[model samples]
Target: MSETESKKPGYAEIASHFRKLIADGTLAPGDEMPSMRDVCEEFNVAITTANRAFRTLKEEGLTVVRPGRKTLVADQPRVAATASARLKRIARTGKPYAPNERSVDHTAQLRSMADPMLAQLLNVELHDEIVLRTRTFVRDGKRTVFAVSCIHMRAIIDVPELLSPEPFGQFWQEVYTARTGKVVTKSPERRGARLALDHELEALGVDVPAGTPVPVLVLVNTFSDEDGPIEVWEDVYAPGLWQVDTE
Candidate 1:
C-alpha cells in the first residue's frame, strides 16, 4: 500500500497534511486555511472534529486563530526548519559545547495618552485623552535593551492595581484571564535582518563597524481574547544573545 493510503484520517492526519502544505510552500505564511465548515465538509467529519484538527495545528505552532475569523498559517516554519538543520549538523561533528544560561528581569508601567485609536482598542472611555499602561522589560541591568509595551487602559480598569510597581503588578496571562476571561496563546512571527534605528544600537550595546551588519530578530505577537484580538506586541532582540528553536 502507498504511505499516504496507510495513514488514518483524523486530527493527526489533517495536521500532517497542513504541515506539508506549509513546508512545501503550498500555503505561504500568513495564508489563511479553509474554514472549519469547509474542512469538515471536505474531510466528511463533524465541526467539532475539524476544530480539534485546527487546534492541533495551533499547538504545533503552525497556525493562528483569529477570533471570529479564519485560521492563518504561521511564517516561522522556515526558522524552525533552519534551527533543526543546524542542530543536525552540530550533532554530526560531535563537538563539545558549553551551555549558557541567563535570567530575564521584567518590569511594566502605565502611561497617559490622548490618542483616539489607542483608546478605542483598550475599550476605555475617551475624555479627549486616555491612559495606557506601558510595560518595560530590562535584562541584566541594560537600560537601552528593553521591551516597551503599550496596553489600553480600558482593558485593565477592574485591575487598576496592576499599574503599580516594576513587574507590572501582574503577568500577561493573569491579566488576560482577569480582563477577558480567556487564555492568551502566543504565536511568534520571526524575521532575520539588520537593525534600522539608531536607538537600537545603544540599547543592544553593539558597536557596528562600517558596513558590517548586526543580526536583528523581531517577533510580532497578537494576543487574542475569547471573542477576538485584544492586543498586538512587537519584541526586538539581538541575535547574539537570544535564540529561538522549535521541535
Candidate 2:
C-alpha cells in the first residue's frame, strides 16, 4: 500500500471517531449509522474491520443493532462536555460555557506556584510567577463547576488584559497569538475522579465535615503552541450536578 494509505486508521481509531461524533451530539440518539458495507467502502477497509469497529461501539453502549442489520446511536449514551467540547469552546469564545451558564470570577492574579504537582506539570520552578485565574460556574442557578487556569507568565507579558476578570470578546488564544506572535496549536487533557480538596469543596459549595473525602470529577488540560506549554487548566465538576461530552 502507499505510505498515506498504509497510515490510515484501523478499526479502533474509526470506532473512536464515531464515539466522538456521538459524544458531541453530531449523531444524536436513534440516528442511523452507515451500514457496515458502506463503512467498509468509505474507510477503505475490509468488511470484517468495519464489523469489528461497530462491535466495539456496541460493546461500549454507544450503538444498538437494529433488526435490518443497521446500527443506530444508543439512546442516552453517557456524555459530558469533556476536553474535546472544552477545546471547541476555547477556540470559539476563549472560555468553556454553554449559553445558559453564568460564572463568577473569584480570583485573577499573578501568583507563585504553591501546588508541587501543578508546578511540575507546568515545568516551572516552585517560586516562579504564574497567572492564576479562578472561577465558579452556575448552571440553572446551581453551582456546578469550578475551574482554574494557570498560565505561563511569558504569554501574558504584553497581553496584560488576560489577567482581567472578564470574558474575551473573541478567542483568547487568538488574542495571545496577535500579541505575542505565538500560536496555540495543541491542548492535551487528562481526567479522572478524585476526592475533592478542601478548597474545591468550598468552591462547589459542598458542605462536608472537615476532612471529608467527597468524590469529584477532575479534568486537567495543558494548552500548548510551537514553543512550549502556555497554560494548564484544572476543572472540577460536582458529582451528579454536571454532565460532559466525554472523550
Candidate 3:
C-alpha cells in the first residue's frame, strides 16, 4: 500500500466533500473537478475510491464526466427534492407525468414473444408472451422522459387488449390484477451509466459529434406482488431529465 492509500476516505465522504463544494458555490457550474491524483492526495484515498465517489456524484446530477478525462460541475444542476416530488405524483397517478408537463404520449403494444435479452431479465424462458410499452413524456412539445416497459405473461393466462396509450398504467394495472389477483406492491429500480450507442443517442435526442461518447443512465426495475414477479422493465433517462435523491 502507498502512503495515501493507507488513509483513504470512504466513498460517501468523498462524495459529500464535493457536494459541499458544489452547494456552497465553491465549485461553480463548468468548474473542473479535482483530478484523480488531487482527490487521492486530498482525501488520502486510492484512485478506485475516488472514481467511485465521482460516479456517485455523476449519478446524483452533481457532476459531468467529459472527454479528455475531465470532470466538471453539471450545468442546470437538478434538485433531488423536485424529482422526488414528481416521482410521488407519478406513483399516485400511475402516469409518467413530470413537473411542467402538460400531457403524456404513450404507445404500447403486446408482442407475441419476449426477446432473449428480455427473457433473461425476466428470468423466464424465451419466446414467452409479453407486452412492450413505449412512452414519451412530453411537455410543450419537448420530450421529458422516453421510456420502455416489458411486461411478462408467463403467469397470466388471459389479458385484455392493452393497446391504448392514454390513461397511463391504469388499464395495464387492471389487467394485471384481474389476471393474477395480486396487487403490485413494489417496483424497485436500480440506476447505472454507460457510453451511449448510436441508436441510443438518436433515441435520447443527444447530439454528439464524431469521436465523442455521451454518458447516459441505464435503469432496471422489477414490478412484483406478494406471490411473485409481475413485470420487469428497463428505462433510460436522459441527462437533465431525472435525478437521484441525495438529500
Candidate 4:
C-alpha cells in the first residue's frame, strides 16, 4: 500500500476531517451540514460511530444548531493548521504562528538527566550529562507546542541561553556546527495523531468535544549528520492545527 493509504482511521480522525473542511472554508457559515447518513456512507461507519464525530464539532462550538434544521458551520471560525506549518512555526519564524494572535514563546529551563539508553543511542558513556531543554508556545491562552529537545549537556553548558525559546533551533544548530564541524544535514521526523488524555485536555485548558475524537499531533525528530543521531526533538501540538501535507 502507498504510505497515505495505510493510516488507521478512528472516530477522531473522522471528526478532524470534517473539522478541517469547516475551518478551511470548504463548509462556510450558513452552509447546510451533510446529513448524518451522508457522513456514515462516506466514511463507511455505523450511525453511532458517525454521531461521535459530529458531537465533537458541536461541543467545540464549531457548528451551530439551527432551530429545526441541520447544523451549520459556526459564524466564528477556528483556523486549521497544516503539518509543515505546524512543525516550522517556531523552528522557522518568530511571530504570529496562529491567527489573530502572536504566540507566547519562552524558554522554560534546562533539566539534567542521566540515561544508559540515550548514551548508547548517542554513543556516550553512562555518566554523560544529557540535558533536556524545554520550550513552550501558547496561542491565545491555549498551549500549541511543547518542544523538548535532548542533547549532551557539555555541548551547551557554555551557552546557557540556548535553552531559551526565541532563537532555539537555528541558534543551537549554528553553535553545535561550529563546535563539532558537523553541519546538520537533515532533520527526519515522524508524525501521527491520537485522542488526548483527560489530563492532557485539562492541561491545555480545553475540553474534548463530546463523542468527538480529540486529536493531538505527535512529532518525533532526529537531527543527524553523516554519523548517526546528534540531537533529537519531541513536540506535541493541539489537534486540527497542523496542515495535512508535510514533507
What are the per-residue Cα lDDT tens digits for candidate 2 across 1-247? 7987897679988887786666545677788999887888788888888889889888777788878657898764433366457566555445455534567756889899987878877878887999999988775466777888888898777678878877666657778888778777655668778888898888888888999778988888887888778888888887664444433
Q: What is the C-alpha lDDT profile of model 1 across 1-247, one tens digit per residue?
A: 7775455378766766666555445677788999888887787667777888889778767688778878898654212323232233334333211111112444445555443543454444445333233322232243222343445455556556545544433254465586656775543443455553554554555677655666566544445556544554545554444432322
- Stretches of candidate 3 above 4 Å error? 1-87, 91-96, 102-105, 112-117, 139-141, 154-159, 167-171, 178-180, 197-199, 209-212, 240-242
Quantify all predictions' global Cα lDDT against the true fold.
Answer: 0.51, 0.75, 0.64, 0.60
Q: Using lDDT as the measure, what is the rank order of every candidate, best first?
A: 2, 3, 4, 1
Instruction: Give the Å error, residue 120, model 3.
Output: 2.8
Taking all chains together, each candidate's TM-score versus the true structure is 0.40, 0.65, 0.53, 0.47
TM-score of 2: 0.65
Candidate 1: count of backbone clashes, pairs at least 3 residues apart or interchain: 1
Quick one: how many clashes does candidate 3 have?
0
Cα-lDDT of candidate 2: 0.75
Model 4's alpha-carbon lDDT is 0.60
Give residue 17's lDDT in candidate 1 (0 to 100): 68
Off by over 4 Å in 4: 1-105, 108-128, 163-170, 178-180, 193-203, 207-215, 239-242
Candidate 4: minimum summed lDDT over ten consecutive residues — where? Answer: 94-103
What's the TM for model 3?
0.53
Each candidate structure's count of clashing pairs: 1, 5, 0, 6
Extract clashing residue pairs from model 1.
Answer: 144-203
